[model samples]
Target chain A: MKLRPSSLFLGLAFLICGCTEVTQIGTSVGVASGTITQGQAQSIKRSAAAVEKTFQDITPEQEYYIGRSVAATILTTYKPFDQEAATRYVNLIGQTLGQASGRPETFGGYHFAIMDTDEINAFAAPGGLILISRGLLRCCRNEDALAAVLAHEVSHVERQHGLKAIKAGRLTNAALVVGTEVAKNLTTQELAEATKAFEGTINDIFSTLVNSGYSRSTEFEADATAVNTLRRVGYNPEGLVDMLQEMQKRLKPGSHGFGSTHPAPKDRIDAVRKILGKPVSIVDQPVRKQRFAAALSKI
Target chain B: MMRKWLVVLGLLLVPSAVALAVNARMIVQVQRGQIRATPSYLASVLATVPYGVSVEILQTKGEWMQVKSLQGQVGWMHKSALTTKAVPMSSGSTTAKTGATSDELALAGKGFNSDIEREFKAKNKNLNFAAVDRMERIKISPAEMQVFLQTGAVKPLEGGVQ
Candidate 1:
């Protein structure tokens, strides 16, 4: 489905044209359709796909290096678990889930930990680093709920969603293709240009990237991955929905989510319901809830 | 005549202003030893500041260098402590040139050495964004101080967020 972007988005189309009279007329004529017109968005998709594919073509070593950088930045912004037991326990759950993921033995495994807060928030950096908030912990009545969040985040990393979003939402390549191996054979000068391109895309649409967030398709992909993961681990997929419904109730009328970053939770929750329409079979119990709660209590 | 003047001016300014663009495999000799602050350090470490790691030679204030790291982590170190080579290796790569530049940058440190190592690794490339975002949010909401506690790695190093 095409995204019906905010007026702020159409205004950006105006920015692409030269600031001549024609530019003014073109921008005025452009409108925010619920979806992109075939002409309007075809180029965007092609450019986004090319850039995204190019960005990931760098050596795996580079991926690890960049991951480390992003992870370090996260640590600066968020505190790690001070308590050794809690830290170790969170890591254990995370690693177990990581092992269960389709790609078990990544060069770097997933790292999850308890954030010392009461906010119902969780974040997964571009790498495997995942942060589960203390506030969010209170809402997770079962391990299924917790696993659901982590699995969704894991899918994001494996699928390279951030890389795709960063490439797609904002990037202006030259009319020329520098080379097929743009990312791989980048010289220092080329690297500088590439980094500038990287920064430009982020600077232009970081708000939309952060606010409007991932496309509904990516969210659905993550959700589907979460369900598959739950089944593999013997957890009921229904717990994901239960947790999401609770999120719906807990969120203030106007203030949804941690923010309007993800697709609406109610819509997601409904999708989950429709998928598991009858939820008839016996599924894994929320046995880990008490242990999870007890483990979190110390923080 | 205008072209002649511009060429002369560019040549004169560019050399002395020597970009010292952290060229790969360029060895720089350190003149002294001194404590340098690192983002990768939560608890201060008594490290042997190497000559090799000093990417930029800002100036000699007495027997030390006010050097800058690739990520903009700047600190003063005594000339006696650095080797004037590249940054000291927690391990350094004695490999080929050109591409070794990328390798050397990669060797900054692993989290295994210190929690700060992990922090540096986690926040690389996006350091400026993360820093600006966190700093601005903290300043705006004093009551939201609790959020900082969640995000911070440790208590203030030298009193403030600097």
Candidate 2:
């Protein structure tokens, strides 16, 4: 008789769901007396495996693991900025905006780092590992503008745009291989297959982050969320437009970084302007500007 | 035989009946998170829990769950930080069907974890795990976060849904 892994998982779910001790007694008694037929037990187990077929079903710990790899892959291209103070300042701004975002807390918590590069771009890996570039920082005219950038990245993480990049067929295949008997150590062959799936998942996200960029709709959603976050955090919502305008002047056609990875700045500016209702004057906050300048000094 | 079957039936039904009730133990899936005094991120932290630690759920309000740690400390944690699935702390144990979820087992350093990352890193030697570790090490405490916000005059709404 072929023992199905899903059937065993069904019993496991039952065991955890029942008062652990009582469920153990029940399962043992049912099996010993043959009161529950093998077919019924197998059917029960099959349904348990179905629960893990989607990206939404990917556990928080799983997302963290994927995020760690994605961040590692990104770091290979851009060295981390060695300035501690600058990194801390960006983290503070990112964390504050994250708190106001829909998902204030993620599995690994929100972490912000600066890549020591002249490339004007940012990447939000899954599970809140956000990396921004020094070139992008230089484009921010003030602290509010910086918050706008970080908030946009935080929105991407909050909405799980990175995970969405994973192809559906890949996730389904992974779920099948891993969900079956994942409760035990995988055999050598299974481990290889699971690792391959992991690599594919990572590549899907990395490619979207670096090569293709998020779909235009996804970028717009992040912008809209960032605007709301800025308002809730008491930063000027117009800072986003200001940042975009600055990028418009600096971004060269066919440039490598944001110029290649993102939608045209003019289009993004127009989208944000609709939300802000015609270009509004941005009030200068000196304290914010002074602190921003202080943080940027080493760069 | 009839009485034995009745008991078996009752035992089988117990899990489904109590699954939604209070006292369900949940695992902490996040690397580390604080249990706050209130159901808000800005609330005073009552305790901290590391990954794979199980906490007893006492109540839930919106996205916040009030949980009691093994140390007997009671506090609130965001739902995103907790998982209903069992989290395996170690590997090499093949005790199957003991109610451990597949996702739980996957996270036990066997699936898409440090073990797999080690394999991946070996294959792709160009990737930088060291920088990833440095990125993970960057942390900001709640007090420091509050101070930073105050310095910049970025005041979040009072009692706003965080």
Native contacts present in each candidate (fraction) = 0.01, 0.61
Segments of candidate 1 deviating more than 4 angstroms: A1-53, A56-59, A74-81, A168-191, A194-209, A280-290, B1-162
> B132, model 1: CA deviation in Å?
17
Alpha carbon lDDT at B76, candidate 1: 48
TM-score of 1: 0.49
Measured against the true structure, the TM-scores of the candidates, in listed sequence, are 0.49, 0.78
Candidate 2 CAPRI classification by DockQ: acceptable
Cα-based lDDT for every prediction = 0.48, 0.78
lDDT tens digits, residue span A196-291, model 1: 443443333333333456778888887888776555544567777877877767655545235466666788887877777886433433435455
Q: What's the interface RMS deviation of candidate 1? A: 17.4
lDDT for each residue of candidate 2 in A87-193, tens digit (9 for 90 to 100):
88898889878866778777778888899888898999999999999989988988889999999999999899999999877764455444524345667775677
Candidate 1, residues B64-84: lDDT per residue as tens digits? 455655445556443433343
Q: Which ten residues in a row have the lowest lDDT in candidate 2 chain A?
A: A43-52
